[model samples]
Target: MSFIKNYIEQQTLNRRSLLLLSAYGLCGMTTAATLGSGVARAAAQNPKIAWSYRDRTNPYWNSIVSGGEAFVRSLGKSTSDLINLINEGSSEKSLSDIKSLLSRYGSEVALAADPNDMPNCRPVVEAVSRAGAYVSTIWNKTDDLHPWDFGDNYVSHMTWSDVGPSEQTARLLFDAMGGKGGVVHLGGIASNNPAIERLEGFKNALKAYPNIEFLAVQAADWDTQKANQVMSGFLTRYGDAIKGVHCASDTMAYGVIEALRAEGIEDMPIVSYDGNPQAVELVTKGKILATVFTNPHWAGGITAALAYYAATGFFKPSAEPKEHREFYGPTTLVTTKDAQVFKTKYIDTNPTYDWKDFWSLGKGQIKYRS
Candidate 1:
């Protein structure tokens, strides 16, 4: 009877030991799981990004999109990680698209945008700020709206001082025309700040040449088709009076050149902006006298990199110089004299700098001149 009791006691002890070991195993697993989960959360906390733009139809926007894609790729991410919302040329659509991206991505996303219009941009800026999403705007903001006004959420604002380049272009155009006769101006969206600056530059250049007359100033809304039609009408109205043409962008200049060809006016000089592939071709062929080369590819990529690095806590915007935060990108005038050199250096040359380097390029914050 005592032996039986001893056996039963031993069995009970063994069962208790097993239960204790099982509990310890479970506790260890729970601890390990908690640690693993924390690591995952940390990875997810890194900032993701999205960008919105006017449309993909234009080569300008394509360069911008490519830059964004390149920047994201530099982070060891796919372009799909950065949401691209194309507005299809509608301000309302752009505003709505931005809101949708903010709603979906929330604070995890940083946005870089060129809003469709000056006034339509405000609501988008406000919406992203309200959602605690970081934003940077390029080339389309009003003077009153500032990044500082909205706190850290509005990261930066970048715009080119188009006046200098435009004036240089105007001078080139006037010289091409032999400082005499009349020319027509193909301006951008009439209300655009860059458009206004460019026009001011053209007028400023005109001050130097007394014989040159501006036959007409028309708004083409930055569309090639509209520019073509406007040029056609101007040709009809002015005929031989038009000796030269000044276009806000190369795309518009293409239209102007087509009209000039239709009218058998190949000798007329033309100047344009945004030295795109077609523009570069025209410049090489001497069809375009001059054009301003604004590195849209660099601008687009750099803005994304800057915003991404800032959002990821790599650099603080507050510590950066005002110029770095919001200022002009580099611009160069490609006149017939230096067209070949410009093409070799900037146009034909493949970009050597990686997209990630863009963030460091804007290390200083931007300062506005009073």
Candidate 2:
């Protein structure tokens, strides 16, 4: 049961097209501006930006990239001007990439990144600040590292509080399982903040439904292929007793679904996060029970935009209230009932906001209520 099929290829192509089209549309004005004196004025006012992420292999990273690109395009500049780097899942690679960017671009670049590892990302953040580049980190970082400590250079840190949303997903999965059966948990990168929070949510939800036993919990490192293998092994060990699957991201959930299909277990309930397009399709088709939509598109672009604007003195991060310095992004639970609505409203519609508008969206406040 290989989950890597034509559908994946087609979907990847579609996403790439959307990204390129969006970039082209937004970058047109920037191209024009660059030919005139406006380029000089804007360059003096706006900072060049960079976005670095774990890897481009996963749809989640693609979403993050798309968001960042969209934001850059919104700034009336070509997305090509933004430095994009993929760490290929290596913390050393990420650190090295940041160092190179800092050395080359210096304070002219504002950086947004989700580090491959929490602790390793700290020195990278510090280095960016030491070089006078504004930095915003999304999704992965040590708790003790705060933006305020690094002054204006470290603009903000945004993450999703996945625990609440994951618990909601767990309840949906449990209900689909009829409250009594064994389930398997396929989590993300072992040390990731969201992975820990989401798994904690799963455990908390399990306390309410003691009848649904947990068969196993394993780290798949957020890889779909790794998840498929883990789920296959869990199915071999648990057999028909496995009634549900909970994965940290939709990418991994796809693999779990494939594993179930291989074992001829189509009726099992599965819940996942990062409501990527294919996962939404599966939910609409009644193949997946539930997933959490993290809106990575907006998250990626907005964080970069905010950091860039702050670096350019559009807004002073130091003047904003303490809560605004670091916070979580909005997350919504996407169930079968509202999956289509979500796709049409957010995923399909594509975002249309000024690149500089992202700075206002932050307003120096943490908006995640739960």
Candidate 3:
């Protein structure tokens, strides 16, 4: 029942690498540049491609924005052409900045944004469509909204199904604790899609390991400092009873780990999601039991590409099926043994992917409970 050991053994035989496919070779620069030229060239105006995210300080956001830049370069355009709308994790700012862009560019825009909150998606997409712009959104949206319902203007929505891999990490943590221990969790924004799903996964894992009691859980808001503060308090309350920790993201795990280290508790089993560079390094050192790699780079770039392609008339969003409109991106579980391989392939050397192969990196449609 030790999922981490099983994963490592499997990885040793399979040589399991990055979340996405192995690139045999890079696409010729010209070949990739010419991909949407026909449709793009036909338009009288160049649709401005823009990407919006929470902020750039976190290495995770930096990688996402980097992907946005790479996609612009593949189009033979300067990275400056990709306008950045940093919401700084504020929903109001997210709405304001997006509205400003819609007003400025009007119909000649292709935008990929994370609304920073699920409820914000509707208004954001509504404004873009009203301005006659093509828009793609990721990670935040209500279940009721559908790209097909809005014709081609609302291009696509992409979010990873975090439950499965998160559950695997939870099982790994519980099993490592010998199936009996008190575990506390540090989560992202409580209402956020991944946060909600990850917590659900942990709860599901508890159903299997009945003796592993969940001590307490708190929202860290995906902030390291907040996670540190919260974990410090958890230490005060639960202390050594907290035998394990589960974080919704690596950033939170970093904080939790530091808090534990400060208290001289180094041997607790912990797992996190989001295989950021630092988190992968921690995994290699056995500081983190396991983490999931969700490829924010591809998420940022493909979200932009989908909207850009739709705007250029390279594809009609209305013509695609619902599954094509909203889909789940790939998720890979990274543990100690395969951590170095993941580091080499995904972190150390940035592997090039065909951004045009958007769905190839995805898993399937985003399913939700009714």
Candidate 4:
């Protein structure tokens, strides 16, 4: 049957089912309770696929959505077949949207999400699990949560270890500053894992360079305009004392550059994360000292593939090892010396990926600090 026709029929059936359940006093009960107690839900056949994330205003998220569309097309479906649940950086909205999907599709959804923040992962997972749907998450999750604890419903979680890569970029920025001067950092949301790790990485690099003074750091919340305003304020406060800049993402770096340009200050050394195409181009032009590429395209495609396959019973999540359940995504440092090469290889053309070969690109199992 055509997916579109099937989707419409399914929507009708869901509405009817909900009305019947409501009339029978089952509306107040959880999906699990409404069905039965202690009876596990079976894997869904041709489950509806969805990707939940921040938004597409940023290049990083745009790439992520493009990857998801690629994966849906690989399934012989149009890119429009993929559902998007944009939270716009709201954790509450992220969870609510997932719940709404669950109420509609029930045990027939395969979701891949970032949960907007770490703490939100739990509620999102709980909602999916209760509805007997499958989920795979990236970037955000609490250290205490484990996939095994929730069985197959929580398919997997993947995150990039930014500490090492962020440190590499920080060292490059420090070197460009001649290893001694004041540097300020513009970062993402303070609660974000990448932001925390990137800041820690910058601090770690600072240990060896006592002459390089840490002037100040602030969370620009990963918005370009906010970053521009923050950078202007920093210029007013620090002026020529600021010799270098460390930005947590390429989006923020663009704002930093514009802020400098407005003041006729263009040569300040800077390093940022997320080797976005524009950022890579900037590196080649020596505008950015360095940045790290995390391959969001592959991450987005493979994450959805994992949840989809698990929902289809192609692989049993419970049988998989811990490393397969939770792991680190890949990262490569892009510097001025190799930026063009990196762009030619990764940016100019998106690498064709085997969505089913899930772990081939994974770095390793994610390790948490004590």
Predicted model with the maximum TM-score:
4
Pairs with steric clashes in candidate 3: none
- Please give the RMSD to the true structure for each candidate, in Å: 20.8, 6.6, 10.2, 8.8
For residues 224-323, what per-residue lDDT tens digits would candidate 1 score against the true structure?
Answer: 6678789999989998899999999876787777777777777789999988766776788788888887788788887776677656766666666566
Q: Pick the candidate with the highest lDDT.
A: 4
The order by descending TM-score is: 4, 3, 2, 1
Which residue pairs in candidate 4 have backbone atoms (N, alpha carbon, C) closer than 3 angstroms, thus clashing? none
Instruction: Point out where model 4 deviates above 4 Å.
Output: 1-38
Model 1 residue runs over 4 Å out of place are 1-46, 354-370
For each candidate, give its TM-score against the true structure. 0.83, 0.86, 0.87, 0.90
lDDT of 1: 0.73
lDDT value, residue 361 of candidate 1: 41
Query: Candidate 3, residues 24-110: lDDT per residue as tens digits?
Result: 111121211112111222431579888877766566777888888989999999987788777768888788777777666666779
Candidate that beats the other on TM-score, 3 or 4, i.e. the better one: 4
Candidate 4 per-residue lDDT over residues 51-118, each given as its tens digit: 89876657788788788889999999988678777776889878877787777678888999999888
Q: lDDT of each prediction vs. the true structure? A: 0.73, 0.77, 0.81, 0.85
* Runs in model 2 lying further than 4 Å from the true structure: 1-4, 7-46, 359-370
- Worst 10-residue stretch by lDDT in candidate 4? 29-38
Supply the TM-score for candidate 4. 0.90
